[model samples]
Target: MSDEGRRTHGFRRRTPLGAARERLLEQVTPHGRTERVRLRDADERILATDAVAERPVPHYRRAAMDGYAVRAEDTFGASDRSPAQLRVGETVGPETATRVHTGSELPEGADAVVMVEETETRGESLTVFDAVAGGENVAPVGEDVEAGEALYEAGHRLRPSDLGLLKSVGNEAVEVYERPRASVVPTGEELVETDPEPGEVIETNGQTVAQYVERWGGEATYRDIVTDDEAALRAAVERDLDHDVVVTTGGSSVGERDLVPEVVDDLGEVLVHGVALKPGHPVALGVVEGTPVLMLPGYPVACIVNAVQFLRPTLREVGHLPHTDPPTIEAELTRKVVSDPGTRTFARVQVDRDGETVTATPTRASGSGVLSSVALADGWVVVPDRREGLDAGDVVAVEDWEWSG
Candidate 1:
């Protein structure tokens, strides 16, 4: 049989997740070009170059409070019993006697600030009983950041605070990697888009996969729901190969109606299928016309899980962005969790943290069709096949939802 013909046959065995991830990384390449984008448009985009500060953050020494700017020496030894009085103009710079509010620039000859509450103000003259040290309540220039300093390093994702800092340094625009474009195709005759009239199932896997693609910094521009005909599937894959990555849901398993792998094999090469993981074990990885195509299962939860586990990482790496695993924290299992002896399992869990103690609430249904369970879940716990089950109070790593609050 030809190399392609071998892959068309049912998967021989399950591949480990670590090996699968390494292979996907090796097969995918980074995007070729970068673009300069406005700072406002750069949020969540990965930086291509280091951003240097053109000037100090504050740029000048300013008052920290609304009070009197005074020379500490002028008020030295002053007290409520033996108060020292001086004409405000003579003690400081001419016209410096004008009151200044917080964040206002300090006037010349002013070395310290005496809060308004500390001094009893009269018509033209003021009496100060308290003495303040010089330079107190002053924010010096370059205190927050130095000029010519690296504000944000390359590969940094632009967050709200990063954007604010960039704008503070007078950067209206920044250079960042362009987001990758993707196409999604859902294949199967029995599959329906949504709310099928009768004798049909709704097509939700495509939408689930598309959402995952977008959340991982890829643009899902094209989405098609097509029948299981090989010609139709081949044409869809060929048209979508123009994109950086093409994602197809359904038809990856060994079922009689499954045709995605066959079509992909005819078009290009299938790198892997039947990963050694539960729920999404039938996932397929392939390339068509030099563009990567990720074939996920038809079940909603399965599609989303596989996209996050495999496809999202590939897209993030290709865009020159860091690939981060879901945030994890050690949490106590609320109850015992049983699993198959040889296959790795991921259980949706609800987590509640109190101070340093965390509790995991395992979901009732972990099936691939239970999309609602994922929504209600705060995170997921990995159950290694070798372990019998997790006991209560045992600490386990919990992979949090991407947007967990």
Candidate 2:
């Protein structure tokens, strides 16, 4: 791993961000796997088939208030001065009323429910002080959902609120597309999990990528650091081919220690080597054994940017999840953000609001290695490839990158 054996730089020509993304995505496709899962295990799962209701919610007529189920016309024109009296019973008739509570099943021959506050019960007799029309204060069959109703179509991501509706429709389990499985392997000889001395770095990229995978609706398997060696890198990749996507962090550049891209290229084909991206131009993409292999930059900020651009979309595609754009907010730039004319830049900035105006101030620690800059930033302002820089006082939209919703 000395300079004498360093790999030559591959940036003879860098691919534009759009072209690189298109190339990478062309080789990736959905796994198309589906499985049945109980409601307890189906949170955030995508439906694989149309969900139709077999049974209507609240199949029986129900009381909507606490009082009595009685004929609506029996209490017409009745009031506290001259209340309508009826005998209490299990069933309702012209002169009889059945006591009921909210959500209670309506008794036979009852057309409506009279509220408890509008009626009084005395010695097995009920007195109604208010008038009610037919079907008032009552939930009839199919009020919430009718039988044979199509609740959801395929390719729909289920939310927490959806479980109750499915349950009410008699669905104890559902068929859903499998979550994309990701193998996040961290590589670098100088990487250590803890107690890092000088020249050694604490491993965090794998964990960060893994967590992001989960947040983006995929499953992640985080692995230990794979040393900077061709054999070790190849084995690490081979071990995770079963996963939907293989993600490797660190050693992705042209340095001698950056052997991941080489290993991937030797095993398969490197779709993209260098991209016209700021702080993360060294990111590489390839496919090995039909699995997309993503080689991210070692620097924390660079890795994050590349992950958000590449891995996030790859996971969504493989898992059959829809691509979601991160939320954004408009803000005024407090300082000029310089960018190369042909390179796409994501400038991290601290956001603040003054009365009615929001401001974005570029962080001092803006280098690829400055992880704190990106961490403290509320979001990022993207300077397009055509724009040289954004001047101060210019209004820009800052993407709320952390909001998954």
Most lDDT-accurate candidate: 2
| Over 4 Å off, model 1 | 1-8, 70-84, 94-98, 109-122, 128-136, 194-199, 327-338, 349-379, 388-398, 401-405
lDDT of 1 by residue, 294-337 (tens): 88998877787788778878888788777676788888998888
What CA root-mean-square deviation does each model show from the true structure? Answer: 4.2, 3.1
lDDT by residue (tens digit), candidate 2, 230-263 = 9999999999999999999998888777888889
Per-candidate TM-scores read 0.81, 0.89
TM-score of 2: 0.89
Query: TM-score: which candidate is best?
Result: 2
How big is the RMSD of model 2? 3.1
Residue pairs with backbone overlap in model 1? none
lDDT of 2 at 61: 96
| Candidates' C-alpha lDDT | 0.80, 0.91
Count backbone clashes in candidate 2: 0
Q: What's the CA error at residue 59 for candidate 2, in Å?
A: 2.5
